[model samples]
Target: MTTSLGATATAASSASAEPGPSTPAPADELGVRAARIRSAELEEQIRTDPRRFRVSTGDRPTGRLHLGHYFGTLHNRVRLQDLGTELFVVIADYQVLTDRDVADDLPGHVEELVLDHLAAGVDPARSTIFTHSAIPALNQLLLPFLSLVSVSELGRNPTVKDEIAHSRQAAVSGLMFTYPAHQAADILFCKANLVPVGQDQLPHLELTRVIARRLNHRYGSGGVPVLPEPEALLSAAPLLLGTDGTKMSKSRGNAIALAASADETARLIRGAKTDSERHISYEPATRPEVSGLVLLTALCLGRDPRQVADDIGGAGAAALKAAATEAVNEYLAPLRARRAMYARDRGHVRQVLREGNERASAIAETTLNEVRAAMKTLY
Candidate 1:
């Protein structure tokens, strides 16, 4: 499902409102609006005379993606791909070690995640999808990145704090503490100029900028900088909640996986919680449960949540639930069928991943080589 130019422009303008982090109001608002206008102009520039401005983003392959993932990140990725940008989609398989107790099934999980991407219409030919573990050079860059960043700085990362709080292990592993550095490596190793990130991840991206600056100061004596400070391409999609009206997550059992069957989707929607007041409305604070349903319907049907609420006027929770269920199921049917076909043809999925890894490694190696040359570590 492609977003229209008008919709993309609107989304870009509203991107400044993403949750978390305080941004400069006037500048952020202006920048977001400018980004929308620039995006159109940039597309024209690329068509007339292509220039290299890469985008790299990823998710940890801990589990299957849900509708929240679709409406939030994946949808935007597809849109960006269509805009003639050099796109790289990483499956951060190594990052999963930060919280997961065991790693025995990681390979299988990564394979499943790749299948999910393909089934969801992520063109393998147009985008490079690789597991983090596959790129040894990229991971090697993490050690140098760690040396560039301070421990005090790492401690201040909110994402790290959140992960440490939720982790079962009392002692935060080196891997967990240095994830920001690894993220820097992921971006720098590809020389990505634009990173599609949510607002909450701004600090991490800021860290990447710091690393790039430090590296350039130390080694950019008479040549091009080895790394580029990637700019954030913020998303404007609303935060999608789970059936329980909480953040949608696999551990919480609130997620409806992208590959879920029709029956499973129906059952999950049927069991979704709603308030005692029979009437449907979009009062998120007062009625999160019903509001969540409204939000879901809006995202699935590409309608405004407020309009959905108005349409359901005197209709009670039952009518709203019925409408939401039908909308979600109808929206997911084709995706579900595609997912099943990919699931059955495991060989095809593997081939896709193998090809993606090769392509990703080729691009990543180019950046790594430049870094080594700049650092005088070519030996």
Candidate 2:
């Protein structure tokens, strides 16, 4: 089943680690509105003093990233880094096992993830990129965080439910069932004050917000919260659809991997689903498939989708595909070159990860110490 634009299973930061909002409900309206208002406030604060915000965002190493990731959150990450916000980009390597039993070629996937970050203009010096497994203290927060939420709350999470249904797993693993706590650990471990996410992931963020408040109320020495309540940094961009006109997901085999060759990109776009109409127009409600293609093309060319459609008016699906293919390939060429260059030097990639792991481990250790002190667990 295809996911709606506002309710995809993936999120901006932990798209790989936790299940996101995949279903819509009336109850979420108030939370969504509140998040939007907070996001606007955060944006204003960021422009004035970007250094004040610490953002925790990342992806799972399930597969190489695609256009959806690039346009959705990757650019935002780089922008935040340039703006002076401290960023913790976790690879969430262990989160892969939440649903699947094994992570095939796990190390390789992690390396590729770093390469994508580097190629996408994410300065490693400005941000910390690390894997989940490398930081034991980070995972230690999970047990405390899990204690804050009830079993029913975990089961009721829309993101987890959608992920379980999508995974088609007959039995849910403990890790998958408690995915929100794991995500809370991810955010609060670094004490991230902001998390970039989509509308659907607001529920997951709400859980994190609750965890922060509960921990503070229960364990704080005075009025200060041990963890700051993180606000959602909602993206204004619409979610990109897959070539099949469904949600853009690597698991569905409908996405174009960033590592794909120019020829491969062209071939994929050529096979993209478009309507039977000969004239192209940007009407997402009426012509989703065709409009998706136009949007992709416009994202690459930095132009408006409607204008792109207007330029290609009267041209059939073939013309639309050609335009998208050319635009995407051209836009991604330099990034691909950087990726290839980095891929060749495996040693350098390893060094980047090693440094990142060390930095993250140190921070996790410090955070864990604080938690232990707050809980009076220090022996």
Candidate 3:
């Protein structure tokens, strides 16, 4: 299934050469260096004065979040929000239609996402949490922004290609092909200056950065740019493989959902694939399955994977599963408690989205007006 959260792209310029399926474009050494420098500078700025940044990050309500979301971005989001950065979390509900024929249980999925966020320690009082469909003004930005990017560029976006290849949609929709443009609209509408992304996603963010620069260069009244060029706030978390030794995903049934009960987490881990070796070791290169379980345990306990592996040495797969289960259950207990509390109050959850949508719409309207004025479209 195509998910907005999992698509990967290389940092190379898609404008020149298109990357083949599973093959990234020729590496752009200069662009890579520039991104690294900018990322480092942004990290320092966030450390000293986080309020100087406005961050835009979100996920599509495809399904319940797994451990991947928790360590990958959700935890960092809470950290950034606590640091006083302006955070806008968009539920890219509309983007779901890009590849899927129908968004089943969309409303339920959205509520679960909010619950997950609240449980994960995202304060709605501090962060603006809204959905794309609720903010018409934000979607409107797509039109003007679409003009700034060429069709070839959109078609060449590695994210689009990856989605199509994985999703295998018989016929791609216009929205599917222009997914990058839509994402650019999502970030630029909020005038966000820092976007948290993985290294594989830099190419997608690069397109958004290009859109911001193009708009500013073409429409800036003075030296001030119309939209801020955003920088990547890369996460330091290691990627967690699925219990089946593949990507952790909801559809695959290998992921342990954040809302899973303690028993469920234990059961899932017990069934996880492991080698026949009587002794456990953290050899990721040769023993990926065993090492993945070790990594999970390490992440949960906040210990080094090697140390965890050493501690588990001579322990069989059963012992490893027991340790991983205990660690994971302990780590997620508090978050799941909060999730249960919020899930009990659906009305309160709905109210959160209502207020966030109103706030997001206001911001988007203001940004849209500026965009129109810059383009001399307003009479």
Off by over 4 Å in 1: 1-51, 100-102
lDDT of each candidate versus the true structure: 0.79, 0.85, 0.85
Q: Which stretches of candidate 3 lie over 4 Å from their true place?
A: 1-34, 98-102
Which of the two, 2 or 3, has more TM-score? Answer: 2
Candidate 3 per-residue lDDT, tens place, 325-358, comes to: 9999999999999999999999999999999999
Q: Is candidate 2 or candidate 3 better by lDDT?
A: 3
Predicted structure 2, TM vs. truth:
0.92
Where is the poorest 10-residue window by lDDT in model 2? 1-10
Residue pairs in candidate 1 whose N, alpha carbon or C atoms collide under 3 angstroms: none
Best by TM-score: 2
Ranking by lDDT: 3, 2, 1
Tally clashes: model 1: 0
| Rank list by TM-score | 2, 3, 1
TM-score of 1: 0.89
lDDT of 2 by residue, 63-122 (tens): 789999988888788888888999999999887875453386888788889999999988
